[model samples]
Target: MAKHNIYKMSVSEVYPHYITKAEKKGRTKEEVDEIIIWLTGYTQAQLDKELEKKTDFETFFVNAPNMNPARTLIKGVICGIRVEDIEEPIMKEIRYLDKLVDELAKGKSMDKILRK
Candidate 1:
């Protein structure tokens, strides 16, 4: 797998890819946004504002209003690396998002995906 500078990557740029992945698998962008909101505790409006401003991942996470407490329960392999074992905090958070998107693409139910 290719390693890219995730911290420097734009959240806005990556978000569309998540929407496309979900949509291709019969999911909706609204569902994708809902998952994002669940993870970051950002309102849809706040997420929209961040996307409009084109913030980088570093900025996006740092400025998140209320990252969910249950996010720590998100565990699994993403890109062959176990998310729970990730040493870097930022990488772990990114992987959590990746896992959520993967679940959505795999047609997992919203309640289950959100760890409800």
Candidate 2:
């Protein structure tokens, strides 16, 4: 099977979309950043650097400082697929982020979104 093109797409390319999805629902960029930080364990500065460098999603995850163990608790549907059921590890990680953003846009409390 062919690798999903999303893996090669720059995180910067999709970052704006995540912010836009959140903002349209009255959420803030900082909240989105917080979710990302919680999931990837990237310090704010490191995240900024990755965005500035236009890192691809696969590399971004691969080089994550500390992928939160709690991310395994993220269970939901995204893009019509159950995140917890995804078989590909990288794809699962991507969908986990997507699910979190979806939850945020749907007005879930940050504590719950973070699975705290």
Candidate 3:
């Protein structure tokens, strides 16, 4: 199988889809933003700026203000792959965010989603 070029994909392009998924499931965009902030430690303002800049995923993650150390505790399957088992660090981080969003859309409590 061919590898995906996720690094070349813009976070801006993907973020709105995440919001839509949450909203369709009766979750708010603010909730989506909150989970993102929790995972990446990016303030709302910084996240907005990155979205406006249309930076690729690689740059967006690389420039994150602070990655929460507790994020390693996030464990689950995403796209049939266990996030904790992902070999690539960047892919693992991206999957961690995906899993958090999945939990949010599934109406998991914010405390639980944040792994409290």
Candidate 4:
């Protein structure tokens, strides 16, 4: 059996209210999961932690240790959890910086495009 971030068997047997591009496009949950895994590099637990912090729509520029400032954070309610978006140009720069740390960890990088 393979591991999954959003749909770990331990979490639940069903994902309610979760709407994703994958879902909209009629992609399998596993396929969508792959894209998420590719970007977040989260090993289930870590992903859950980030997901836990999100509870509403909030945008900000984050500059932590070893990070470049100018990233736009777009986090909001998605299937009830807070999902972050960093697709804005400002955030892309931050994503690039984070990616520099480890090319393999780009999956978890914050660089989601804002829907609005």
TM-score of each: 0.94, 0.98, 0.95, 0.31
Candidate 3 lDDT, 22-44, residue by residue in tens: 99999999999999898899999
Highest-scoring model, lDDT = 2
Off by over 4 Å in 2: none
Off by over 4 Å in 3: 1-3
Error of 4 at 114 (Å): 22
Q: List the residue pairs that clash in candidate 1.
A: none
Misplaced by over 4 Å in model 4 are 1-18, 55-90, 93-116
For each candidate, the alpha-carbon lDDT, in order, equals: 0.90, 0.96, 0.90, 0.32
Give the TM-score (vs. native) of candidate 1.
0.94
**For each predicted model, how many residue pairs clash, with residues at least 3 apart or on different chains?**
0, 0, 0, 10
The residue-by-residue lDDT of candidate 1 on 1-116, one tens digit each, is 44449988989999989999999999999999998899998999999999999888877887888999999988889999998999877778888999999999999999999999
Clashing pairs in 4: 38-107, 39-107, 39-108, 40-107, 40-108, 86-111, 86-112, 87-111, 87-112, 87-113
lDDT (Cα, tens digit) per residue for candidate 4, span 65-105: 12222222433433343334433443343233233222213
* 11-66: candidate 2 lDDT, tens digit per residue: 99999999999999999999999999999999999999999999999999999999
| TM-score of candidate 2 to 2 decimals | 0.98
Better of 1 and 4 by TM-score: 1
Candidate 2 clashing pairs, residues 3+ apart or interchain: none
